[model samples]
Target: MTNVAKARESAVAAETRVEKTVLKVLDRLHALNARLVALHGEIKAAQPVSSGSVCLELYPCGPGCAGCPHPRWVKYTWTVETPQKPSVLLSINLDAKERDPVLTLARSTPHYEKTAELIREAKSILLERKKILASIRSLRNSARL
Candidate 1:
């Protein structure tokens, strides 16, 4: 074959390889986006009911220490009620607590709010991934490879 023909063949082969590689990347990106969506769903499922508001209160250190000089330790709790079972009480002591006089952050176990934020973040990522996949498909189609 002429040198010009051989160069054209090499260019075509290179273009096809590029297209295939891009298609694989697009597939993987699409798969990851799907996984992210599924993860977001799972996180949302762990969300607690909005009705069960958490309560925080201070309890006495002891009867002897009615006027305790030290700062009061707060208790955090929430109740879940269902017809099928007795009411359930859930509580957790926050880790890495700041010794500020007012520890309002520990007042609630609002996992739903945090999980909702995560769901939003994951959905945004999934949206961007889908956009990238669309752009890749557009490029592949435009290139006619």
Candidate 2:
């Protein structure tokens, strides 16, 4: 083959390889997007139960109290109900009657588990796409010579 024909063949081969690599990367990205969407849905559907008992201890005589001359302490016990078989208890301390505290519990429920799995799968796909991109870069560099 002439030098010009050889160059044209090499260029076409490189183009084909690059195209294949791009398609593979796109497929992986699509899968990752799907997994993220599913994970988001799972998180949105999760419901947590916030119910427990609260106790208040009042002291009638203290130097800091403006009117009653006493200090009071409040204690709250909270439990989180998960989709799993068991529930967990959360303990909180309240300083004053005017304070209403909000607490969040991060537990592994069924939805959480599914979300975690989807995240893992998405990460794996991302890693795969990264490797493919690296391979394409390597091919392009080699073709430049």
Candidate 3:
């Protein structure tokens, strides 16, 4: 093969390699974005109290007057209402020192950190790919001359 032909082949091979590398980097970025989206869903689900708790409606009558016109013994009903505010409920039987499991899980998960690092790396890779592609285009133009 002629020297010029070999040089052209080598340049084309290099450009192909760069394109493949850029595509791989973009695929990795896409995977990272999916992971971030999943993590966001988990974070939202782990939030305290997705639904409300049960409430009691109490009716009090005259003290110690079981036979009074207003009977001391009263009947009450339980109802469920959505919590308008944030509050944590602890069972009477559980130890007060128990830690929150949801919080612990969220804090320990590496998804957030990994997502941030992936975003930075993806941005850098994209920028580098753009530059390399421009160079490849220039080479093709020159080859046409």
Top lDDT prediction, candidate number: 1
Models sorted by lDDT, best on top? 1, 2, 3
Alpha-carbon runs more than 4 Å astray in model 2: 49-104, 108-145
Q: Write the per-residue lDDT of candidate 1 for residues 55-139, one digit (tens) a residue.
A: 2223346664312212122224456667887765554432225332123332356564555455445546545665665776677
Candidate 1: 10-residue stretch with minimal lDDT: 66-75
Comparing 1 with 3 on TM-score, the higher-scoring candidate is 1
* Candidate 3, 28-144: lDDT as tens digits: 545544454444444334333322211111134568522112101111123344577544443221113343222222334445444334333433543454555466467667987
Runs in model 3 with CA error above 4 Å? 49-145
Colliding pairs, model 2: 62-69, 62-70
- TM-score, one value per model: 0.43, 0.40, 0.36
Cα TM-score of candidate 2: 0.40
Angstrom error at residue 104, model 2: 6.1
lDDT of each: 0.51, 0.47, 0.41
lDDT (tens digit, per residue) of candidate 2 on 14-104? 9999789778766765665455455444433443333332222224565642223122223334456568746556445554444432112
